[model samples]
Target: MPIPSTLIGIPASPGRAGGRVVRVAEPPGEPATGPAPADPAGEAARIEPAVELVSTRLTARAATVSGDAREVLEATVTMVGDPALLQNAQELVTERGRPAARAVWEAANGFAATLSSMGGYMAERARDISDVRDRIVAELLGLPAPGVADLDAPAVLVATDLAPADTAGLKPGVALALVTEQGGPTSHTAILARSLGIPAVVGCAGASTLTDGSAVIVDGATGEVGEVATLDEAVEAAAAAAVVTDWDGVGRTADGHVVPLLANVGDGPGAAKGAADGAEGVGLFRTELAFLSAAEEPSESRQREAYVAVLSAFAGKPVTARTLDAGADKPLPFLSLDGEPNPALGVRGLRIARDGSGGDGAGVLDRQLAGLAAAAKETGAELKVMAPMVATAEEARWFVERCRTHGIGRAGVMIEVPAAVLTADEIMREVDFVSVGTNDLAQYLFAADRQSGPLAALNDPWQPALLRLIGMLGEASERTGCPVGVCGEAAADPALASVLVGLGVASLSTGPGARAAVGAAIGGLTLAQCRERAAVARAAADPIDARRAVAALDG
Candidate 1:
């Protein structure tokens, strides 16, 4: 059957492009059964070089990028270089005389299966494992690493999903846009595409049917794709969106209501980029990158250095640091939450440090707070620390006390659970501020996995249920005189930023690439106009209707 003329998908990184489709290279297939190797010792020795090759290649790729792209690549390198995985593969070769490639494949798959079964964020890691497995197997088989090949010219890269290494290697001007058959808004493809300033449309099921070298137009803003005939129109629309008005390092509405625009940063370089991009402050300073690679709990001095880099980058500006949001997708070696089939709903986020979970979570939290306080003292930057997964007033109060005990003045909690929204009044009084983590809130509210492509609509930020939850928290903020900010992927959407303002959110935090667009979007609308649009959105029956209703108002 012929492919459709137009394809609809989730709008990931917003822009538009026209190019011929170029699919990613196929991954290595499983090897057929073969006879046992004659020299097990020699076969085991081959695994080291193959592993080293994958690690070295990924390290080189990682060095070429910075910010989120570099972080994701470094993570892949860590997975590939895990000593336990190499040891396990060697055991298979020595004990059962399995071929080196097959042993590596089996060992990697075993780990991937365990991760996939845990569901949610951890499940995404399973895909990373598959990518690593293929690369290692391809090395053993003397084939090129499986991923995007060298493009002779600019084109729209189509794939089921891109591995971090492949996505990291993409250059802004060469890879015009990205279209994927799977992956939600927060996938590696989407994150890297935004960082690289490339337009992208993901979760397009029809992408697999696109013929190679066929010209097509992709609208990353509207999630629309069409045949070559639409190229001229798409090019014009893209040009208009590309001409973004420069932000002047302030966030305010047309009628002069102030809103703080902040950046979500991962590390020192990311923070520096955010500051350079005219970000007023650091909104979501993810403190997990330093811990992800640690074999044991990072010492206070080590953690202080990590925090100091970001603090120094944005000195005197407010930097809200989230403490150790580990478990689920990011399980630490020192702080184990093993044997949980459903880690997402189980002990994740703030639940990890909750009383009586049979782990040293409290110690972890205390030491992290001490390091953050020390960084704050050294840098003289305004530091506001928050805990993720706080669903009750008790958790809020407990976290605040811990922060105060460590000499951290400002403390807050993330409103990611439904209960957090419903009981916002009590929780607000216990903390200095609250930040709505819309990604997790949408996932839990709709009971859909945030990473699932087919369920992307339900997990969309425009969903009325999610909006209403934010509205509820907004009301609580107003009543208690506590500030509420949004620090999720949703906050990056320009139109949504206005709606959030109308909903009484005090600040909007997003990636560096989005700061200008979001600031300009809010600057054009009055508070009253924003409220009217928010009402129009909340009155709709579904996300599609809500988006259309709000767009109609803009027209």
Candidate 2:
């Protein structure tokens, strides 16, 4: 009999294994019989050891990982051990008269809720803290920690949810493909798995229904996971599948034309990892990562450390660091943010920087300019700072003036807003370079929320309108003598990379896995051929036509 095969979705991660299933079910609910802690002093004494233990575990784990993985873990540990969080717990226990455990749980939950509601970077940090708190609480109660998956043997890991820390602990050699019942494509697990070159599937319902010891196979390329009757068949499939590598260089067209391959980095570790993976340089180093994880606004020194780390990691290679782009979608708690009915359209990106009054006290523009200037002076790194969500020439001019006032010599703006694409010529004249953020560009062009399931169709980067936008930006770059690049999903896409290069995008920055494939593609074409192909792509009315045009050119 053939092995029963079932398809399921899960967040992607690295490695492949075959072992008996080890389901980590949620712990049974314990009754709330005990009264709340009557005193803050008593609660502090009770919770201190547990917090210390969590800190120790986190520290030990942080020491084991490399690159951004280490930074994120260490940051999480710091947040977990924060005095404010502990004091808040103590206060809750004293005021509510709840049990020590209950007080800590409620306080942590409240904090997490506050962070989540705050949105943007703070919310992401809040979620991290909540995860840590759950693990700490489990340790205190002697319960199996949530998100912990044991990898004592070779096996495919199945989980309802896997936190970043738990995912980091996964031994690539022992663990096979990861299948999860929940998580999105952009989730940390998915991003890490892609980084580690692991096969994973996410968002699969009823994944837990599969029996232990059932044979399985996962196809990361196609996002498929299923049970197999025979282990031999599974192994054969795994063996036959090609592993993706991150060897960087320049991308090429089918006819052989060079296209620089770069990496999108958010922090120092990310830059280091990208460099190690052979990224030509940092394509998009989001400066906001440093500020998001902290409870307080990051000082200039703190900002400098982050900027220097990234620049040093690249060893003097060019790093296009985007200035603070935080706003409604990515709320900063330290920044005073007024609630907006439509955050995507509201004050964000270059608008926030220009206005300087979008609730975060001092304008984001001032802080970003100061940070970039300080980082440049400290590291002497070849820094190219850009603004996000810029839609007009005037915004670009204001941004350039601010950068110059702070002594930043190189400045640019991202063309993500549709208005920017339409007015690229005017905008390009005010900056040193331009990079299209096609993800947001596509969403805004189609009037769709890229994050919404109902708007999936509109989120396609290959949509005709988005391609036209790229063409328009390219035309502006030509007219203004500004070097344009693309640091968006479309840039990393092997299928679309050639088209972007052909459209006069001077550089294409993407995730590591795409480097070689793109290099191979671009290596096959000449610059003129790419230009012609890009012209054809611009004229195409639909995705199918665009793909067909490129395919015909290759053939």
For all predicted structures, in order, the TM-scores are: 0.93, 0.78
List runs of model 1 lying over 4 Å from the truth.
Answer: 1-5, 35-45, 119-121, 230-237, 240-243, 336-338
lDDT of 2 by residue, 26-75 (tens): 53233242565456577656777888887898789888876556766777
Tens-place lDDT digits, model 1, residues 69-185: 887788789899888899999999999878999999999999999887777667777778889999999999888878998899888898887887898889977898998888888
Candidate 1 steric clashes: 0
Query: Best candidate, TM-score-wise?
Result: 1
Error of 2 at 428 (Å): 3.7
Q: What is the lDDT of residue 533 in candidate 1?
A: 83
